[model samples]
Structures are given as structure tokens and as C-alpha cells.
Target chain A: MTNLPLSVPVAPNRLSLSKFARRSPSAAIGAALVVLILLVALFAPWIAPYDPIAQDIANRLMPPSAAHWFGTDSFGRDLLSRLIYGTRPTLMLLAIVILLTTPVGIAIGIVAGFYGGMVERILMRITDIAMAFPKLVLALAFVAVLGAGLVNGALALALTAWPAYARQTRSETVSLRKSDYLAAAEMMGITGPRLLFGHVLPLVLPGAIVRMALDLGGIILIAAGLGFLGLGVRPPTPEWGAMVADGTQVIFDQWWVAATPGAAILLTSFAFNLLSDGLRDLMDPRNG
Target chain B: MSLVDISDLNVTFRDQDVGRHILRGITVAIEEGETFGLLGPSGCGKSTLLRVIAGLNRDWHGSMSLLGEAVAPRRRFTGKLRRQVQMVFQDPYASLHPRHRIGRALREPLVVNGLDNPDKRVTEALAEVGFGPDVASRYPHQLSGGQRQRIAIARALLLRPKLLLLDEPTSALDMSVQAEILNLLVTLKARFGMSFVLVSHDPDVIGHMCDRAARMAEGRIAATFDRPALAAGAAAAR
Candidate 1:
């Protein structure tokens, strides 16, 4: 190698959490809410003052008071305890759906994008058909055929949700396929799997992650919707949506039972949505 | 013996219908260690020809031989061919992977070519391109236009290719940076003793760096000229 000046000692900026929080306080807040929810879910047995499913027929449908902070449900189950325990199944379903869908969708998208023409046409058309169906309706139909359970509900939701990731990632891959860096890589005799995993995947992944983050809240809501419809996790389980569904019966007489779970769902879902927005802003290079 | 010998090269968008010809029966030759310039306007197939030599466009009717060996269009380039030829793209901004550090970008070619000790090679190559160890850690976006181009060149040279195919390497840069890059390329060429097929629209660039030059128009080589020994004489006199 020819000699040239080693003039500069570069110290590039490191991305620290505090820096990120300062840049996007909304994301920070969202993350804090999510962490709080996770902590409550993890420590539900310890944190919850009462057993979620222990029926006290005498205390049934009581209004909010210090003795019963969120009052009692129609079944006389503690509303606060049930709300805390409910976070577990909601988050569990979300985790399962994400695990099942993200890889499947990303794989399909990469294949469709890398090999255009007949493969792309066929894959995209299938995705289009899947995407056209209302996600909840499609999940309901799947549950109708498969029978109702947490696993079935998760499977159904994953099946319906995968198309969004597939379509989004496919479009991302399609655009990046024509990238000059890829063309440069091709010229350097870097083709096939190495080119795909090393080059294309890295470029396509951040966008997919942003989309996944945005979709997380929707996934949680859908899981809850499935539970509320009596198609998720079965009865006797202390799930938020099921709790809300149970409380809906005595609406005017006692609002605390339904309101507690409903508020929990609203707050958590809102936190997720805000987190996604914050994440989008944080990850976006243009924002920086 | 010619380093690049392409003959009767005919590239069309569609072979079935005699579709629009991109390169029409074009031929060119360059000697080993010679700086050959392709002077042409935009969309005149100059870049296409360079791409063909770089083994990017395979759908073409041509007999292409580098260092006197025929190349098959659809086949993977042989290891020797890969190591013997490298290209510096026109747009420096778009050429380097946006997500990768300059060091990784330089190392990839060596790794792909199965070269041993890539870390040492990359460090040495970085220095050759007027970059320090710190530059290696920096992403392409962090660097200036000229620095990015230098990284691209460093990436090309990591494999120590016998021939460098440069497509408008300096045209995108400011006029000041253009001269610096031109000088860098000329110096590197002397040190490496590698041939270059430089494509540019600027005649001054052609006159400054090239030993022999050719003008291209509408997918054909319109004319060829020999400069007075790498323009050193003319540049000095000016």
C-alpha cells in the first residue's frame, strides 16, 4: 500500500440511552410505561394485594373504596388483581404472534423481492389477498374453524398479521434491490446468500423493525378483542378482555368492574402506540 | 497482450424481438498498466461497457477476454477474474453500503475473494486512500464526497485487482476535489502498476490522466486518440 497521511483520529458519536431519551422523550415515556406494565405482569402475585380469581360473593359489585381499591367484579374477583394478572396473557399472546409472524413474513418478503417476475407476482398476489381481508374478521374465521384457545387465537392472529410484514418488507426489499451498493457488491463477485444476508438484510431490517414496533399495539388490541369475543384463552383465566367482557354485564349498576380492565387496555395500548411513534422518530435518520 | 479485449459486443434489452440496442457491435482494447479513457456523453453506453467488463451485465452478445481469456456471460466469475478486476462506481454516495463502516466495506471484497489476513490488508488500504485508522470506523455518510470516493477506491484496491474500472469517479465531486481525486488515482496507478479503463464526460480529465483515449457515442466507439504520455507534459506546461 502507498504511504499517505494518517491525519485524523476519529471519535464517532456513540448512541447512548440518555441521548436517545433526550432526543425522543415520547419513546422514553412509552418505554417506561411498557417496563412498568412488564414489571406488574411479572410480579402480579406479589404486587396484587388479593387473589384475582378468589370469589367473595359477599363483596360482589362493590364500588371503589380503600378496602377494594378498584372494587369487585360481578364474580366478586378483585378488579386491580385481575387487571395486573391480565397483562400476562395479553403480552404472552403478543410475544407468540410476533415470534411466529416476523421471521415467516421476512423470509417470504426477501425471497419475493430477490427473485422478481413469476415468484414475486405469485407471492405478492397471495399477500395482497391476505392483506385485503379485515384482520379481526380473518382471525375470527380462523378461530371459528380451529376452535377457541389462546394458542389457536395466537395462531389465527399470526396468520392474519404476517401479510402486513410480508408486504412491507417485500416493498422495502424491492426498492433496495436496485440500490447502487448492491450493484457494487454484484460487481465485486459478491452474489447469492452472502449478498442477501450480509448486504440486503441489514438495509431492509430497520424498516421492518419500525413497522413491527408500530404493529405491536394493534396486535395487542386484536388479541384483547379476540379474548373479549370469548375466542381467546377460555373462561376462569384472569385476562383483561375477558374481565372487561364479564364486567360489561352490570354496566350501569357497577362501572368499576369493566372500567378497570378497559382503562388498563386503553392505557397499555396507548403506551405501545406512543412507543412506536417515539421509536419511529428515534430510529429515523432524517430526524437526526 | 491486451488486458481488456472486447469484440463484437452487442447488448440489447430483449433478444427475441431485436429490442433497443444498448451496445451495438462495440470493440475496445487496453494494454496492461495503461490508463485508457472513455470520453462520452451521458446514456452513450460508456458506463454500460464498463459494467460489462466488471461482469455486472450478463445478457449481452460479446466475446470478452481479460488478459487473453474468454469469459462466459452467465457463469460466475472465476477467482482469478474477481481478483484481477475491480470497479469504483460513479456515485460515491450510493456506491458504499449506507449501514456499513468504511472498514467493513473494504474488508468484504477480501473476505469474498478468500484472501487471508483481511484486517491487515484493510488497514494498509485505508492508509493508501489518505485515511487513518479512525476513518475505518466511520460510516460513509459521515465522510465528505471526496473521502467517500477514496473509501470506494480503497474498497476496490483491497483485492489488489490488476485492472481498475472507474465510471465517472470524479464527475460528481466539486472541481477542486476532482483534481485531488485525479491526482490520487494517477499516483495510485503508478504505485500499483495496474491498468484502468476510466469513463468520463470531461475531456480535461481524459487529457490529464489517460495515456490513450477513445470517444463513444450512440453505443459505438467513435474515435481513439493517444495523449502525450499521461498528460504530465501538458499539465506541467499549463
Candidate 2:
């Protein structure tokens, strides 16, 4: 009595790159762009034609030419070199913010959802309070309190970032908590941390990762905002936001300085947005 | 001592200001190695009763004993009590973790219980469920409905549970696949020498599998049936 459509042909578990590219070309292009940026950041020192900090006053404000591509800053430092070096801090802040936020958010969310009672009330209230505040304002407050630097700016962003993830994951976990698979797990005596980490975490991770990717563009903007506000990494580090700040003074005469770093920021943000959209499509069960 | 003895079981769910009673004063005893069936229509607390026995519904007020040990309300099943009880859920597609491979899903109980030879047990489970070792690497979605149900059964049986609770286990399946799964359960029950508390709306299923049966309605056991009565009822329904 094996009636019900006996064994539908199984699809391969892994998605081939060619198939992914074909399915979501925008994501593919985004991925390629992001990879290129990473490579540029990774090899900044070697790839940059001149010392980013070494100023040549004679060539000051020289526009884009054979001798200097992307022209020179007020200090006559290579704009190309500065832009390349700027990628390091931007990428690092992104890494730090994600690393700090995701686990903390996921843990709080899971614990609250799985154990729903006073625990859920307290955790969700805290999340609500955190979310109620404007994220930029909260980050600004945190940076002001902690003092300005790369780690401090990242910390400030991290403090404001986790609540979104917590709320997202909490909602997901709440629904998953009522799922039959979880009920089956409870029957198997897999309670407490094992159930939370093993059963719940894996199921919730795709949503979290997609959210993280989507949030990356916002994170880059916020980090740049912090840098522009004079609360980011110290000057002469060639941060994109700080360079933009530097370029604003001579923007009327030599607009390339501000525009170059501004373009880099925009491209990075666009890449993340495209990648997140592609990932969302890829992870959607309907698409599958 | 009975394998499962429950008396005066009352399960109430409070939703804000409303209190809904799901199972009211359920009393039943399942003997060792006996296949007892709870036959009922939808909304009759049969599945809730099953969940109570499996320790998934801890909010019930009742006296329950499994394997001669009294179980407390709001307390988790642990050690021997936990290992001896397992449940096959209604939906095969929803019961098994979609992300987990068959081998890992089957082996998890063994690993969590700190049992030895998980790989060996997992292999044996696959074989017992009529699956090849290659099936171990497959995800739940890759399998047919019957195949997934078999895997769910395999996962439940890996612990060698003495009392296996089935909550409309084949209700989600097609007629033919349902029969296949029902027969698989019968064979597995015999092989493992385990007691079963089967819940189903079908009298045919109740008569075919259960040694004794109870007809329940609106959270109450309205009638109990002996084997002959069950058979007669099933025949009449047919």
C-alpha cells in the first residue's frame, strides 16, 4: 500500500554557484563586488600606489592625473590609497558589530521565547525600551559616554543593534516553540540548553543571517556617520567618513575628494542590500 | 503495575481572561505490552491525553503513574521515566526536524541520553525501518510521506521506549500509505514488545490494531470496548 506518490526525485542539497548566479544575478553581482572590496581591503598596503599618510605639499590639491589617480587630499596624500585603507576600519566595525550583536540577540530571544513567563516579560520589555529609542541617538549617547574610537563606536552601534535581532528572533522562536518538531524534542527529554541551542538555534539562524546581511548596509552608514561626527577612529587613519569630512572643506573647488569616499560607502552599502535581497529569496521556502 | 495509569486528569488552558478545559477527568490504565486505543472524534482531548502521558503537557492536574512510578504535575520526566516513553506525532512532515539528517535525528536521543554506540544504533534503526544506510544522509523533505513517517517511527524506537504513544500517526497520510505505516507500527510493536496507546478517529484502525479500545467524546471517555465489540463496531462502520 505505498500509494502516495512513491518517492519524488530528490533535489541536490547544495546549490551550485552557476545555478545561484542564474537564479539571482543581482546577488551574484553583489557578492562579486563585496569580494572585490574585501580583496582591496586585504591588500591595501601593497596595492596602494603611495603611502596614504605621507604628504607631498607640492602636489597638494592635484586633480586626477597619470601621476595621481583619484587626485590628492589637502595634505597631498594619495586619495586612492586613503580610500583603500579606509575599507579596513569599515569592514572591521562591520565584523565587530555583527559578532557582538547576533549571539547576544539570539540567546536572549531564544531564552525568552522558549521559557515564556516572567522571563519573557522582562526580556521583551527591555527589547521594547531599547527599540523605542532612535538607534542613532542611542549610539550617539553610548559613544559620548564611552568616548570616541573604533572599538567604542562599534560598541555603541552594537548596543543599539542587538534589540532588532532580538525582536526578530523572538518572534520566529515563539512560532517555532509551538511546532511539532519541538514538541517531539521535548518528549525526547531534550530540555534546557540542549533544546535551545541544538533544536531552536539551527532553525532560527537562517532568518538571523538574512537579517544580518540586510542590516549590514545600515551598519556601514551608521559607522560612517559616527566617523563624520568626529566620534570614530582618530584622524590620519583614512576612514571614509573622516575623509568625506576632510573633503567637505574644499568641496566647491575639488569635489572628487568627498565624492570618492562617498562613492565607496554607497557601493559597499548597495552590495550588501543586493546580497541580502538575494539571500532572502534563496532562503524563502516558497522559492525552494 | 500498569505501564501507564492516569486518573482524574484535568487539563485547563488559560488565555488571558478565558479558561478552556481541554481534558476533563480522564482516567485510563494501559497494561504492559497491551495495545490500547483511544477512539474519538476531533476536539475530544485524545491527543491531549496522549501528550500528558508523554510528559509534553505538564500543566494538567492529575495522578499519573508510568512503570509503577508516580509522576508529579509540572515536573519534567527524567532518567528512566523519560527513556521509557516516546511519542509519534500526527504530522510526519512536521514531527521530524527539517534541517536535521535522518542519521543525526535518530542518533540524537542516544547521544542526549549518553548511550554508547550511537552509530550502531542508528544503523540498526534505519534497517529496522526498512531504510538503507544511504537514507541516513537524507533530510526530511527529501523523503516521501511514508518514508518520513517510517523515519519518525525509527527515531522514536531508537530509545527502545516501553510505552509508545501514537497521536493520529497516519491521519495525515494517504489511505495506502496509512495502512503501510499502521502495519509498520504493528510489526515494530511486536518486535520491540512495547505497549501502545493509539489515538485515532477511525474505528477500523482501532479494531485492526488495538487489543482494547475506548470511545471518547468532548473530553470524556463515553464508552469502552472489548476486542469483539471493537471488531463488531469496525465491521459495522465498514
Candidate 3:
């Protein structure tokens, strides 16, 4: 018998941060912007020039001055400080929603895809019903029932967010179920959860993560919308959507009031979008 | 007793309203420690029959027995039957999981079966396929087609299965690599004393590897060749 070659060249196991940045500049920029926002949120108290909620009637409506950088709102609160504090709730809500939805959605999807037939029909139909309703309307209905607090708002958004993940994961799992590796695993007597979670779940994760990143921007927009409608965090607590609502009243005279928080929301969503696009490109099977 | 026995095996796939008959009444018996070849052209259901024997395709009409135990249609092979039969697929590139390392893939079957000393078993299996210990750390994408096929062979043999079903195992590799893999299979089969049901379109491969071979056309065994006939290249003629 001919001997197989001993020395075969191997691809690098890890992609360094610098290499990743060089490969996809937009993702790098997005990551940097996200890190900056996280830092701002983390050190809001230390970084803010004045207390976010503390009103200084004398400084009310101040515009782009040396003392009040982003100017003061109608409540005479610092717009910059309020924006800084606002980042906290938005990020917190996102984390909560992701934690709640990813596992539930993936589980429902894998079970449906793996079992197929009647289980697939029932689970997918339920996912479809959940998906059929307008996301904002369903979230609004949920908030109306649950009452508006940070966790409740997060819960409402999470309920609407999971169906899309379920659909994405289910479709991926359906195709993966036919793959040769999975079939080989089955032949070895690896069945049930061990096969599904061990063999199937890892293959489906990259796509699901890319989907999650893409969904982040949309989740932020919906969260901000809830805050604008007075169904978010209780009053006097800084929220980007509430701040924009606060800005709209004096938009004609003082555009900075609404503009500052509006700019923050736009930048945050844009960062997530760029990050997701880069991730999708990197994780593409063709690229691998 | 025969290692594998099947009589009148038929497989039909139903899509919506139409039922397509893929395997139409195939009967074959493989003696213990024998290499039986199923030689046929594309779309002749050789791979389907291999899948049936491996228990990967359970939806079939047949009276089948493996190592003397009968198997029912549309039922999963359980316990010893499940572990005794293993299959290596056609494409080397697609057979192994892309994300998993070679070591993990080899250890998986042993781990699943609750066998002890998985690491040692993985090392031994790799060595049996002419691979060194360092090869274990590499991913499937890193390996060449020949290397991947060897790894696939090692994984199937890790369970010490009684019957190994090969679905065009070397068809994906080039000329030189195919010979190496086929030789490797010959040596491994001799060492393990295992029966193999090899499916291929090439008559040369069948004559080289199989002790008793069947030439299939349109899902039926058109001719069966003994050692003398195969040596005379009777399979290639008709």
C-alpha cells in the first residue's frame, strides 16, 4: 500500500483583530463606534457635565454653548447627559431581548426542522401566525397589557423578535438535515438531542449570529418607538425616543433638542447594520 | 451464516401524488469477511441499496437480515444492529463536518457508543489509515481529497463495525489517490476481517476489490461474477 503524505499545509486557526479590520474596514469602524457608545453608557455619570435629570431653569433652551454642549431641553436637563444615560436602557433592552429570543427561537426551529412533518407544520404555523402581525403593533399590544417598564418593554419586543429567528434557523436546519455529515452521525447511532444539538446546532450558529446582528438595528428602532409613545421607561428617566419626543415640541426654535438624541439613534442603528453586513460576508460558506 | 442477507428489496419515493420507484426488487447475500461489489452506471440505485443496508434509508419494502437478525421496513436499527453497520459516503469533501477537527470527528462514534479510551482509539484509527497524530488537529478544509477520504474511512472503522457500506468512496478522488485509497481499504478489511458492500460505476475497481461482484442495470442484478470471471474482466465486457 502507498503511504499517505505526512506534511500537509494547514490554514491558520484564528483570525486576529488587525487581520479582521484589514479584511473588512466597515465592520472595524462599526465595532469601534459600538465600543465608544458602550463606554459612554458605562461611564455616563462620570462623563456627563451635569446630572441628566437635574433641571437648571436658568440654563433651559441654551444652544451649542461652551457650558452646555448639546444644549438644554424643555426640562432644562442636559441633552448630552440625557443621551449618555439613554444608551444604557437601549443596550440593556437589546441584551435582554437577545438572551430571551435566541435559545427559544433556535430550539423551536431545530425541533421543527429535525422532526419535520406534523411537528414542523404546527411549530412553523405558530411562528407564521406570530410573524403575520405588524411587529410594532404586536409590541404595542404587549406593552399595553404588561405596562411600560424597562423589562416589560424588552419583553414586548422580544415576543415580536423571535419569530424571524425561528424562520431563519428552521430553514437552515431543514437543509442541514440532508447533509452527509448529519446522515453519517445518524448511522453511528447518534440520535435525539445529542445529534441535533451537537452536530446540527453548531452548523446553524454562524447564520443565526449574522441574522442576530442584522436584527439589532431593527430592534433598536422599535425600542425607540416604544419610548416615544410614552410606553417605555417611567418619566424623568432618560430614553432616546422620549428625548426626541421632548425635542419635537421646540423643534422649530431649537432643533438641537430633538436632533441630538435623533442623531444617536441613527448612528447606533447604522453601526449595527455595518457590523452585520461585514459578518455576513465573513461567515459566507463561499468565503470559507 | 451470511453477514448480510436481503430478498426483494424495493424503495419508492412519494412526492405529492407521484410515486417514483428507485430500487426495484434487489436480492443479494454477502458471506462473512467477504467484499461484495455492486457495479452499475449512474442512476441505477446502487447507492440507494448501500444506504438501505446501512439503515440510513429505512423506508423500504424488504425482508432483510444482518449477521442473522431480521430487520423490518420503516423501523430504525437499534442497539447492536445500529453499531454493527456503518457507511462512508461518496463525497470526501462533504462527508466530514466542516467545523469539526479530525480528532473530534473520529472520537464521536466511540463517545456516542460509550466506548472507553476515545483518544487512544482515535489515534489508532488514524494510524490504521496511515495518518500521524498531528493530523488530528487539522480541519476538513485543510485536508486534500485523498486525506479526507482516509479520515472518513478511519471514522467508519472506529466503531469496529462488522459491515462497512462504501458508496463510491474513491470516486471523488483522482486516479493516483483512488488507487491509494482502494489499497488502504484492502489492507484495513483484511486486518479487521469485516464484510464490505462496495458500490461503484467502475468495473476495474470492482474486479480489484470485490471477491464476488454483481453487475446491475436499471435497479436489477443483470450478472453476477465469480473470482475467475472478474479476473477475466467479464464485468467490463457486458
Cα RMSD to the true fold for all candidates: 3.0, 2.2, 1.3
Model 3 chain B: weakest 10-residue lDDT segment is B214-223
* Error at A202, model 2, angstroms: 0.8
Question: lDDT tens string, model 3, A1-288?
Answer: 334676667768687899889989999899888899999989999999889999988878889888888999987898888999999999999999999998989889999998899999999999998778787887788889888888988887788788887888899999988889999988888899989898888888888899999999999998899899988898899999999998899999999999999999999999999999899888876566
Determine the iRMS, in angstroms, of model 1. Answer: 3.2
- As for candidate 2, its interface RMSD to one decimal place is 3.8
lDDT of 1 at A182: 92
Higher-TM-score candidate among 1 and 3? 3
Against the true structure, candidate 2 has what lDDT? 0.89
Clashes of 2: 0
DockQ of 1: 0.51
Please give the lDDT score at residue B105 for candidate 1: 86
Worst 10 residues of 3 chain A by lDDT: A1-10
Native-to-model Cα distance after best TM-score fit, residue A258 in candidate 2, in Å = 1.1
Give RMSD (Å) of candidate 1 vs. truth. 3.0
Please report how far candidate 1 places residue B68 from its true position, in Å.
2.1
Question: How far does residue A200 in candidate 1 sit from its true spot (Å)?
Answer: 1.2
Off by over 4 Å in 2: A1-8, A285-288, B234-238
Instruction: State the displacement of the C-alpha of residue B61, model 1, in Å, after optimal TM-score superposition.
Output: 1.8
